[model samples]
Target: MRHALILLSISATSLFLMSATPLQSQTEDAQSIRMNQVGYFPNGPKRAIFSSIHKSDTQKHFRLIDATGKKEVFRGILTKPEYWKSADEWAAIADFSQFTQAGLYVIEVQGGVLSAPFQIHNHIYEYALNASVRTFYYQRASISLDANHAGPFSRKAGHLNKSIPYHKDLGKAQNARTASPGGWYDAGDFGKYIVNAGVTTSLLLMTHERFGSIFPDGSLNLPESGNGTSDLLDEIRYELEWFKTMQDADGGVFFKVTPLKFAGKVMPADDPSLQHMIGKSTSSTLNFAAVMAYAARLYGDVDQSFAQQCLQQAEAAWQWALKNTSIRYTQGTKSSNYKDVQTGGYGDQHFEDEFLWAKTALFLATKDSKYSISIDDLPEKYSAPTWAQVSALALYSIILNEESFAKKVSEKAKVMVQQASVKILKEVMAHPYRINQMNYIWGSNIVPLNAILTLSFANHIEAHPVYLTTSVELMDYTFGKNPTGYSFVTGFGTKSPLHPHHRIMMADGIEPPIPGFLVGGPNRGRQDANSLKRYGGYPSQAPAKSYRDHTASYASNEVAINWNASLVIALSFLEHQRALSIHEPK
Candidate 1:
């Protein structure tokens, strides 16, 4: 008994000593700064490179070096370091706007660290825009790619569900063929979802509406390029055609067409699985109506016949929504299980938002006072709109068309804009990240990007410099001002994710992930066990620190179509605004 007590005492003392030992030194890593690898200057807005340096190392200076010869192009001291309490470090800013001479340059920091090589030229972002927009082409389903069209990323066709037969319940035989094929895959998967497509298509259409004159006919290099219409509209029309196929004879829109189960990690051409054109709900029908109406007006001058078809379909869907208003997506036992637990369900319990969205689009398409009556009671503030919650779309349409409406409607629209702008500005000032979210959930990167969009809208209405400045600050956070210090984009920055959760890039044995794809940033949901397994026992619980670069970390690193749509819109706006600024007299 005495020997046992002596052993226990010794073990306790050893445990105490182990607990008292200090952790390893928390030195700042060299890969902590991120900036656009392909930069711009002279005719563009000022570029700011970001770093998270230790508080003790705040006085360090950085130099821009000529990449070809290792000669120093310029040296500049970093701006006063700002401490981020969430990250427990000081954020550093390095501005290279003064280096306007055309050259290939790399930013060099202390201890011989270097950023990715970048160029100072007028057309730098033009290349980025092309790459970003063409990424959608690579994600096209029911289509074949050749070397001429997709370059080295060519592959065979996938999911040619052209002969999609109606379900037996629709009074048509399930085995009979009905033509329905062609749309961009929703994400890393080869699925086509209506709710996700609605938001993505809206953003793309808005892009064309704003920059139609700027982009040339063949800029995107699609198969339909130089076809007497802008390539941007051509790309959108491809998806819009597929969207038409999703609507039933009853004018109801199906939620999605997906495999019965999630596919393995394989190329789109390799995934030879049966596709199920699944269930429809009120939200999906209303979303379909909203997108169709908006597209009808945009395509009016370009293709009159197609525009008229879109308007007819939009009216039909709106009528269907009016009759069956309260239906939500429930996994009915009838037919095959399209419950969609595997992919995104896109279920929205709030039917009012979709109703309002469809109403606004219909109002814009036709000068109908009936749609205007529904706009009296608007939401107090806008919460960075998404597929699930899209009231902001209605708000935007109303604000844009205020002048065209009578006093009763226009006055309400103006008041909603002012209230929303004040709310957004207040939130932007309060947050340390300079964005408006309280927590970082799944697809958190979209939060800041959406805020940038709202700010741009407000700036358009009032033309305040503060709105633009705040927008740029949010852009800085996205590029790399916060924790993780990694660019959210796959290939634009000094340090970016090489192993994105993209199946094509993974199966192709590529050296780097596809360019211009924006990975979902820092999702603290941490729900996937696959992600947790690859966390190396160091998963961060904090909202800003929850991101990892591993391919298995899909929660933090998966790229999605809707997220990229937001990015394309934001970046295109910047490029367009900058182009105008360049020609302005000083």
Candidate 2:
């Protein structure tokens, strides 16, 4: 454990840089300190990075000051100023990992420089997991969010969808309607897309599966609090039950349920618009199949009938996908005469990933050799999972289980994960902030969470102290230890997003954005500048610094179900790890 801690510290000499497109900057504005604003576990690794544009402003020492006590608790000499000038002007670590007192404190340098205050309690991350999980309940459609459940964010039920009509593109009359009701609003808007739901539900289910002990019955205080199931599963079942409605008679799944255009800042209850059953695609069917098959395995003992139904539906969807092998979702625009907008689409021409995922899940659920794919077909590159690509998720499931596949296939899966970890570890060491992904894209925050989720899975495949510490360090980057210095999630941390690009929070008259939501962080793409009229510009063009906490900055600020699912998984996994190791020293 001590060796793992040493390797993770910023004191490590060798550093690497992946392919990154840095936004060239010469303006003098880089004097800041960064650390996890949400706080840290008492026994876990603690680190802070300080940056300055004044290449000459060399402060040799740093101090840890208690915010409440207003006294120096510890002090240490800063590392030699190195040229980490790509993202940071000057950088060094204030690693007070040994000062394990439970209190509120900040890292200080040069007498006045201080980082955001953070707590040092054992249960520092408890509310993060609970609040993130509860946000799903808040995202539920058709159910009124009463004061008892939603607190100040309460609202009248909206998008009940008692009659959802098929869109003109669905080979039906424009007026046909179906009673497909009640799931999550997929992202910032009210529409719920099956493709998005598939990944979101899968990750949430995986979280509950591995960390089931953390979320007990009635833990979340949902309406289904005492219903003999964990509140986490109860919330997930709401999505699963809705998944039952999206399936066609022939076992196919609809791509999405959304309006043609977006509603302009209208509250859910007041937004009078129609949602249509959008086109169906191969990707959606396969995603549904994979999630359902995976879920069936987990829920068998708790809900036998539902589990059986899920497995049957999963097989049927897989068959439908096989028959209609090439359909893609080139459907309606989220553009707004009709209203409620959903999230993005799956890949237009790639169903290979989908096939691999669906096949793997079915193989696991049924233990049937026929559902297995060949080891030769395994993806050469294991990228971080997105809605469009989930082969990595399939590989993770395979690697997590002991001898779940043919020897060659299982060995290949483990190698792929292990290879990815080595690459990720290099990125973690090379980046000044110790982040894995340096080139920011849309929903950039999801990359690290997914990567850490991958690392957590890697640890299960082959136990390594480095994997655990890598997960913890990258998790630190998520909470606020990076260049952005924002917790990236709403309602946690000393500094967090106040205005995310979410319609509910925008129209609900709430002063703060919805709690537990993780915004699309620091997208250098700046797609919002073109999409919104008179857009609020991004703070910087740098890949890691190009974020704005404005409701109009959808490129960087929109909250999504998939992103929330990843955050919940990463945070809860660490929380589970903390519980395991805290007792070792106590």
Candidate 3:
């Protein structure tokens, strides 16, 4: 037992010596002092440490501590790309080495009357060889030690330019100038007109319900004019009034019209040469009325009597369309009306079937059984109709409160929605040169059609993967790329500009105008001296090409409006579905 005690004592002494050795060595080692520390703004022209400390609620403060124990602080601000060009600056600081403890240090910042603190820590390298490799690697990448020779560290600096002065006097001059009004403008640019009106009305209605305001100025700003909320509403009101003026005594709208002149023209009626054209058929007339029904509802609160009159006119238009179904003419083997020749037989007819969309909208407004019958009869004509046509039928079914019918159509539509992803891919491959513009056969039309179809099928069927994918692609293509700029130059080539009248006109005081008035000249075959010069003295002078030049000839204004409106509606529905999904029982 005595021998065991002696061995235990020796072991205890050795353990105590080992434990106390590090503590004694830590105090005896020469202390590394920090010196000549500096700080500056990020990317700034100058490099100076004006103060020892800086502070801000939103900004992060950085510091460099030297071997002599002196420290400098840096104040930085974050900014976006647009702001970076005009505002923010950068700064470089001296080396820091004295604060190399393996623990966090809280450094205080003095902001005149305020103060703040930030914590920083020192990292140790377990493998010096790896550390040397990392240092060499960074050096090879054009990053190395500064004048202080303490660090080869890289940091991203985000700062706002506080030095640049702001001026309010130049605000008026800074406003974007309006383009010249000439060349081809929308005579009856129906699609865009309707789509704009529909989106405007829907947004106004939705916002009014939430905020008790007729227009939400904070949210809706005009892209071109940069107009405020009130200005947008006034613009919408002006357009509605213009549309009202274009209404015929029979309650039907003309196929096309010039909004500025308030002159209405029925294509075949006004131009005898176009009487044989398939686009001039009465089905287009019915579609116009259907659009009018929704417009009437939107403007109803403002003019109830006029709104009621529009609904009645829509009913009459539907009746007229049904009666004129048999009026057939010839454009080659393809019948001008009644029969489907494009897809062979009427098994997948959608050309004139689009008229059913108006029928559905009108039925929703009036709840007429005839509209319901017209919609139900669609399946009898086509063995398996397209999602676009069936979606329209489903919408009508929903209006009739026929849940079963809606479910049936919605199921079919859901499958088509899945097909949309593959369909879009095919569309891209089919038209490689101008996938966004020239390939109207399946490009622009399919996108919006798919959106509306998906919306119709939303609750009745499972959400289609293509619904989300195609919608995003369409929005990106339309609002981001195509509409802004990327349109085809028509009239100069064999292909006539799609609905030449719908393009916004811009005058350059040049003659022998180009197709789109917004970017080129009048393009009405009138050659002037200025136009010749603008065309670079080419033997055949033509106008410049812009994306806004393309228009849907079938019903330009209505189609555009409907497409955009459908997008708005679909988005709203999707949001509502998401909310429901979140709140649903787990």
Could you say which candidate leads in TM-score?
A: 2
Ranking of all predicted structures according to lDDT, beginning with the best and ending with the worst? 2, 1, 3
- In order of appearance, the predictions have TM-scores of 0.84, 0.90, 0.38
TM-score of 3: 0.38
Clashes of 1: 0
Candidate 3's residue-wise lDDT over 1-586, tens digit each? Answer: 2222322433342243223222212211111111101111111111111122222223433343221233333333311111111102121122122232322121222232111111122111111111211111111111222312212122111111112111111122343221111111122321112212332343323222222242234322222123433323333443444444333444433332212112233221122111101122243445445555665655566567867876766666666656655332222244433232121121222335546556656755666665553324343332112322433432433432444344555444344444443455455323211122232231143344344334334433445433433332332222112211221222111112333332221111222222211112112232233433443432222221111232222222112232322333343333333322111111
The global Cα lDDT (0 to 1) of model 2 is: 0.77
What lDDT score goes with residue 51 in model 1? 48
Indicate whether candidate 1 or candidate 2 has the larger TM-score.
2
lDDT of each: 0.71, 0.77, 0.30
Q: For model 1, what is the error of residue 7's alpha carbon versus the real structure, in angstroms, after optimal superposition?
A: 69
Q: Model 1 over residues 438-544: C-alpha lDDT tens digits? A: 46788888877887788777866787656655565566556654577676776555556788877787787667676678888886677664645745832466667
Candidate 3 deviant stretches above 4 angstroms: 1-240, 250-253, 258-281, 296-303, 326-355, 374-376, 379-461, 464-466, 478-505, 508-586
Q: Output the better candidate (2/3) by lDDT.
A: 2
lDDT of 2 by residue, 1-586 (tens): 2212322221121111001112111122222677876777776677788776345655568888776667899998766555553353567777777787887776677655655566787776676777788889889998898766666678998888898888766676556789788899988888888888888998888888788888888777788877889888899999998898999889999987777666668888888778778778898899999999988999998999999999999999999998999987763354221123343545458988889989988989998878976877689888777888888878878876747677888888888888888889888877766778566889888888888888887887877777877787787877788777788878766567998888999898979666688988987777777655466466566677878888888888999899999999998888888766642121
